[model samples]
Target chain A: MNPVARLSSTSTGQAAPSGLTGATVATNAAESFPPLGIRRGVLLGLAVFAVAAFLLSLAVGSVPIPLDEVVRVLLGVQASKDTWQTIVLVFRLPKAITALLAGAALSVAGLQMQTLFRNPLADPFALGISSGASLGVALAVLGGAAASVSVFGRAAYLGDFGLVTAASLGAAAVFALVLAIARRVQSVITLLVLGLMISYLAGAVVSVLIYFSIPEQVSAYLNWTFGSFGGVTWQQMRAFAPTLLLGLAAALFTAKPLNALLLGENYAASMGINVRAARWWVTASASLLAGAVTAFCGPIGFIGIAVPHLCRALFGSSDHRVLLPAALMLGGGLALIFDLISQMPGARAALPLNVVTSAVGAPVVLWIVLRRQSFGRV
Target chain B: MITHRFAFTRPRAIHSAPDAPPPNGDESAIRATDLITGYRNGTSRRVVHRGLNLSLSRGKLTALLGPNGAGKSTLMRTLCGLQPPLGGTVWIDGEPLHALSPERRARKLAVVLTDRVDVGYMTAYALAALGRTPYTRWDGRLTAEDEAIVQEAMRAARCEALAARAVAQLSDGERQRVMIARALAQQTPIILLDEPTAFLDLPRRIEIMHLLRDLAHQTGRALLISTHDLELALRYADALWLMGGDGTFVAGTPEQVHRRGELLRVFADEGTEVRRYLQEIHQRWTTS
Candidate 1:
């Protein structure tokens, strides 16, 4: 007889080998809690931090309005000077709100990209979005009559609208191309590599444009690249806010499929998730969030790459349900804090938003990578 | 006593009528008819097998055995609806496989593959809860009943204690059990697995085979496993599907296939001694 039959015949009543007994099976079923209480605590803390950061950003700008006055004006109590009111309500409030939206939007996009690609290093900007937006602005300022149009009437108004429009369209075009390529590629690493190549291609195009453009236009492009949240007006927010909200909403709906995708495509499909449809939804939502933010905020970096890592580290869970809200709060809070620091409080010259963001964001990403001891997630 | 007499009278009359189809056909959970398995490269098709007919009956454990390059994975993939057949039809529990939506198909058939799941942060319970994906709402929130089902699947797969543990931290055997629990939580009538024992040690391999066999018999669910462990397959599996070197398939009881010498046809090319060894084993089994 065979060894299997010989063993089974020797041990008639027992189901499995002695090594795997009922007692051992019972012992093997050890349970561990997922730190949900801690996650809730982190969420609450982030929410508070985000609110405080927003208030600080509004109160500590060039005029340095008192916190009480900032609150009073915000509550419409009429305690501050009219000039202070104008700075607080007109200039700083919208800018702070823009910072909040851009931070949340980019962070959520980054989370989706990281999860979908199963790569920890993937960011919203990885798909050439920032470069695409830069090329758009470059073409408008250099190739078009944007400079001469600024020389005409209503210069600030027309110029901002034209640049925002150009940036949006340019980001959207590159996003469409990435999605088109993504459909054919099954491997996440391949998709990420394609995104990197596209970024390089867009960067090359932007460099050629920069070389030939006038010095003033070149400066304009360079200044935009440094990034800021100061220029988004109420009119712009109407466009920016809704798109970000819609993208976030779409992302939340994909929370289930995104979790399934963590196991890879074959497993996700077996779980009844239409892999292709989920991929499309993820790509569309990620593109909309990142693309719209770049159009308005000049492609703010770091938060998109860093906030998701921060959320994962805090919550100790990969479930999108928790990570989504956590990222939103943390991203908004971080962006507001950086914006406040960049304003230089008492000084007239403000630091570039990207400089403040990268200084903060790069360290967090580096620390996470080292702590995890891996550069890319499997 | 009158009720007992009545039960016997009516049931006996009904049971006497031969209304049921042949046992195999009546219990078939999945059937493939004249399946042409192959891969498509650009405009050309490389066919693996043609005129293939196979039936996996409910409450049966079938072991799909084949050598390397025998297109076992391709056939398994095609049967699970992961890839479209080159030219054939697959029916699941009386419904056309293609006619069912992915959600509907999931409700009918669950698949367990050898691919490693790299989700580090999810607990085993949450991963198993994903099996309720088809039944859950669009947002994928688990209702109380869904949670109970997930818990029951974990218990059945003997991973209940590991429910709270991170999937990434689990050992290979533990992870495989959790994956099986996830498939069980899917609650489908038919489960297809590709090399479920590929990475396991000898004891774990035997244990997994026993577990799968018990699950199939107890749940009345059909299990079709593709594996390289022919010894365990012959011992535990109720039926065998052997893929030949020339891309043909034969299905029968292990004893029947061995008696018919079809096993030799597939294993002969491995070596003359291997074939002789198999013949010797067959002689001992038959004599015993």
Candidate 2:
């Protein structure tokens, strides 16, 4: 039998001490954690929830296709109407897929960041990856107007692809800078503060570009900042899906190092982990995930920061082996649900993705803080 | 005195190994030669201690006692390979410490640090299981043998009752035992601990000291601990490494060093009252 199961069995076999109150014994038993089987069952339930959320996302958009038709179109059967087929296959499917991928990628990245820094508040963007991407988008949209550069004219010809390339390059630039600094610095806190400074620098540069640009260019930058999942198209998925999958794979590979890190870096090194190499891998994977999502999906927020915390609470453990997969599914499911809410089912007008996410995410974050204060648990 | 009571309770049979020689002989588990320890920042260097030689032997508990700023931490860090020694070399089990790969070094040496392990929500069992990292696969999945060793280590540390409890929820004493359990689970021939008794109460300190001494005896592993608990160290430790903070170093059995008045001399700067109190305590214990 597995160690957890064996432990639980032994604990169950022992009678409570006579002096202990019933309430204290109950609390002790609860704190022992649910058995391994139940935790696995929770993961299974999360998988089902993710699938159901994806289906709902497909069926409940502004066009409102029926669930049966959505399933039929998914299974390669003919839909009753051609428009429904086009909507399901061409539009809704890609958007839903983007939401799923973006959510999972950001969440796994966030989980890594939280563990690496040992800060509960840390997210993928804590390293200023999204800010770096924003600077790229801002330069593409507003700097082009200010400088009137012909190089940007050609970039404009590539449309959204040009914007994505710019954002990716910008994020990569920051990632490189951070990695360079990480090599020299001994502490993660130094890296975190440097990241914030880099973010401010980028934000300041973008602000200058915005000040010089016309209203149309300014709005264009603003729309990107609002964030959206629907912006990614089928052709873009060729680049988007594979990048995210690679990032997620890298995250899964880091389970061992991350577990060691929970005891802190010194302890991790004592355990034979090459601390420097492990930190590099974690930063690289987290940067890649956050950067890629921001490039394709315009820096979606809340899902990255919130999902990992939610997973930790629900799963009742900090073991990366459990948290990584849990975050992947729960993050994707939450993102899909938020995306559905953004679509506003019966209304033609859609809310900005960030607006819906922040609206819901802020409260969840508040609840977590309150709960932690009351329970003295992280 | 409390020391005499605990001394009487100690299992003296474990010290009856016929072939075992006194410490500082050929049975040294870790040997440092002409060692210099310090920190370097860019172009500037600050040397803490210089040209020192030390050896820790198997089947013994050695207390590394020193006043604050006496280079105790720097020496410990250098010995564990956490920091590079400015000069000289350290050897573990006859192999140069710097030459060994991290994996090999981990297998040969384990450490329990003073750093607070705020591993939120991790069970003691799970935390102890991490000691199997060097032996386990890349994913750190513990094998059946690894699990059994972990359970045994916890049992040996007298923390088997805390196996299912979250480490975060453990009392300081319980947590210290769990951390010791982790080091024991590593199965290294040598273990180093920095201030293992700090932040613990009087009874807890004695309990931990007794446990460490017992562990060293039972497992025949060399154990070195840097601590501020002078009384406990004198009572429980087999040997003592005294860093006098004035470029003087002394090593010998606790009784030998005390007889030479080296312990009193090392802590002389603590103030006259502390020195006089230590002398009184020493007089009472020795006479009793």
Candidate 3:
């Protein structure tokens, strides 16, 4: 009986399972980039996305344009094609440019905010810059003041530029208020709460103005809140683009000092930085970029809060030397991607950019809070 | 703490012009003639100290010792330009301190201020490298030489192990070492440390004083440290600046201060138990 059992066991083991033995065999190799090598790969992906985003943006919208025709049109060469010319020149090109600049500006502003406030949660809107600018725009458009200025200034051919200039100044006034508050309030949470409170206060004012105002003006003011790249035409782009670029360039230039700011103001000063002046410039740039985008393209929020986190997670270093460029590329790409998602299902079914951003952004923010709670900020 | 208890002899007024610096640069290293330091509250005011005269120079490790509110820290802050001298000027290289560029002043003098540092996300290397900020361009990139000096500073303060770690995670003593590292990295001719060893354990405290004295001797850099540790101060200092009540003050070589009995005058009170402790320390060290 024992012999028969041994023979039966031997027979059962006759067919041995085979295992793969080559280098191609699945192994527990790291699926994520190593810390140092991450920067190179993320940066590469960012560049690819930035280019792809540009093409996708150019090929999108109600007008049907092929990618090759759009590319030709973009190059300033005559597209032998007709609809391509209209699509590229009229719709996609301006929207694409607006989306790109807006993205870059918001991300850089976010990066500055996080560094200055020393909080990972700080973003362009965290200071209430967008809300403040929105209030300014609402006042201008609804107060019957901007309408009069628009008519008289454009009638004289000088008011066209005047409106945008007024808009920027209006936004700047609120930014200054926030900066002063930020100076006195030392804690980041206090500043953040202050910003949120300011936003609510501004919203209240806007609501009162809208309730007392005519329906048409109310609709226009309401439209600005949904956010749009479509509003910034070539003329608006000309006025808006420089403001965004200058702010971005300044943030990029300030990368090193931002590293110093991690040491706190007194230490930063002892380190030979003009601490007061640096704080001023940081506040000013964050406001200027966020305000301009809000003024021209409406209040775009979630991108400013999300892109830096994404960039930091991808690159694995808070050093601005690598982080700034990565943030810039990733920011521009993310903006275009969000814009693409918003524009899905054609013109009639198009969504707001803020809606798309919030959809992506809220979850990331929740993930951040949960992760931070589960394990500290380490 | 050697109490010589000698007769006081006031210094004769040298008939040099106020504007003309003396040819002897050593005498001109630091001078506070009848300085009055204080604070303002709206229209009201209060004085912290008055009629103070102190001079320091290169090749000296000076210690300022006093009870709390003897205006020691206030005076130190005023002298270092963190607070404006209410009734006098802080002159460096015979010019008003306020007139100098921040960078120029930083190069001439470095300070390790009382710590309330809140620099999160900064590495020890980053913190030490900040000492070279005045010498750096607006972009603030450190040169190879700057990097070397920062590394040397880490070694000098025995913080080489903590170089890559975040400043927040460091212990109090380690933080003190980091701050000293920063000042050392500054490479200035005049360095001031505010209670540099306050957070340190006994051995580390002695190590810091030894490092300061050796650094002063080798580099001929003037070092001024304020502390309440009478024993350590007496043992290591080149001179003692004693701040007495009602703005009474005297600064001299350790021998001179002992002879003048200023330590006994400021400390060793007849009533309080705290004074008894001071008396005991004073007696023990002075006798030794």
User: What residue runs in model 2 are displaced by over 4 Å at the alpha carbon?
Assistant: A1-38, A153-158, A376-378, B1-25
User: lDDT tens digits, residues A222-335, model 2?
Assistant: 888888898788999999999999999999989889999998888888888888888888998999999999988898888888898899889778888889999999999999
lDDT of 1 by residue, A1-378 (tens): 222233234334543323112222232224442332235777889999999999998888666788999999889888548888888889989999999988988899999998888888889877777778877777776655434553221332256877788788789888888788777776667777777887888778778777776787778777878888887899989988999999988988988888788888888888889888898788888888889988888978889999999888787788887888888888988888888888786767889999999999999988987776662443
Model 1 stretches astray by more than 4 angstroms: A1-41, A144-158, A178-194, A374-378, B1-25, B273-284
User: Against the true structure, what is model 1's DockQ?
Assistant: 0.28
Per-residue error for B120 in candidate 2, Å, reads 1.8
Q: Pick the candidate with the highest lDDT.
A: 2
Pairs clashing within candidate 3: A153-A159, B1-B286, B5-B259, B6-B259
Model 1 chain A poorest 10 in a row by lDDT: A19-28
Candidate 3 chain A lowest-lDDT run of ten: A17-26
How many pairs collide in each candidate, listed in order?
A: 3, 0, 4
Q: For candidate 1, lDDT tens digit of each residue in B104-167?
A: 7787788889886888677888888888888878777776666755665675676777888877
**Which candidate achieves the best TM-score against the true structure?**
2
Docking class of 3: incorrect
- The TM-scores, one per candidate, come to 0.87, 0.90, 0.78
* Cα lDDT for residue A100, candidate 1: 91
